[model samples]
Target: MIRLDTIKDIIVFLLAYIPPLLVFAKFWREKHKNIIVLIIITLIYLGGSIFTQNLLPFILIIFDIKFIKSAGTSYLDNKIDNTYNKTKFGRDINSVLKFDYNRFKFNGRNFSIFSALKLSAISYTVSLLISIVETILLSRLNVKLEGQEVVSWMSSMQLWRFIIIIPVMIIFAPVVEEFVFRWLFFEKIFKNRMGIYLSALISSLIFGFAHFNLRSFPILVWIGIFNCYLIDKKGYWYSVFNHFTFNFITTMALLIDKI
Candidate 1:
């Protein structure tokens, strides 16, 4: 049996259980209505999984974007001059981050190749720092890193798991996560005329909360805020490229350690 040996462990345990408790409370308060609602959702999901052969998620995403709602590039005008704007790296990166939309329309130019390279190098360096922090924290905790079991599975002869997880981490994660957190979420928060940093902080807190990793909360918030600012200024692809590079480096590191 696992023991909450320290105050940190107890706190972590409580934080982990809070979400589930709140969810249960919601249903518990109105069991009749909530249970029926839950059953309907479950039935629809079951039907979709059966009929669509697990393509329901894709179908839902398409429906959400096309019919339900889609995130726009809002709050781009709220950016103001700052100390970071005066920095060399910031100026250079922002220059490349600019997309020539008219050029894309006329000459088919999309994004600067140099920006992609810059994002890759920057992400690699940042990921290294994050990995170091993660190592120190994980060492102190009894709990495993999120998805740590995947490392052991990969080390074994789990070729099918390899086929599934590798692409999901490197490809799907970058696109989906960046869209949800940076694009969709940031727009939601910045709908009011407020300080950009406050909006970023709220969203970053939620991002960290969503991960269910108490130990990694600060790291996640830093990533969330950084990506928020990045996506705000640098645009979607730039942020996605950074996230992609970050995940790719992490996946590669885990693979090397396991194998």
Candidate 2:
């Protein structure tokens, strides 16, 4: 017999999946879209993650080989170049990755680390407030919402688990996500003025929905927009830095909470 708790869990899972599925489906149906490429990249990412988690370490131990860095760099470079060529921008991947400090100037002033920090602080503070308000509203309405996946995962992990995941989460995730969402989607796919704005909205909504957290959806969307704005104003590196800072802060907060 199916237990009541199992049924509740299934219901919650479906609720979380439905909205993102709908958004993704809409994007898929749109012509001239890169949905297929996104799907392929996602599959490769999952497969590589599984292999790294299960087999790669054992292989390295057995062979005493320490070439993971070069292999990983080659893999990432190929993937980025493939995606770049597929996009409308048609720019070289190296050029896309270049950092231009002159581009950082905003309204006759140059961008600085302090400016980025201030923006991140404001974004995080406002998003946290919104999340708190959302949770309270949902509770008042008798709606049961699940906690964010990252927070829940972190809460249940030990120090060793954190040590294993920190580089992947803080370093790799921000770079890959910014490249896919902000650089590819907003900059390459939607290169025009109106299209760029529309892309930002659509991409932000999709990014938020992709997280599968209703309570934190608005917060994620705000972060997405902030990242997109950074890409638009400064460059891809700026957005990557902002994303890395945000993730690093959140990771530290989670660790502190666990402690």
lDDT of 2 by residue, 1-259 (tens): 9996566545533433222233233334332358777577445534554444323222222121112112234335556535533334354323343332234221224547787787777777877788788879988999987878777887789988887878766776665566556755566556555576688988788677766688778888988888888878766556767778878988888878777
All candidates: CA RMSD (Å):
13.1, 11.0
lDDT of 1 by residue, 57-95 (tens): 333333333221111121122235622222332332222
Return the top candidate by lDDT.
Answer: 2
Residue 141, candidate 2: alpha-carbon lDDT:
95
TM-score of model 2 relative to the true fold?
0.60
Give the C-alpha lDDT of model 2.
0.59
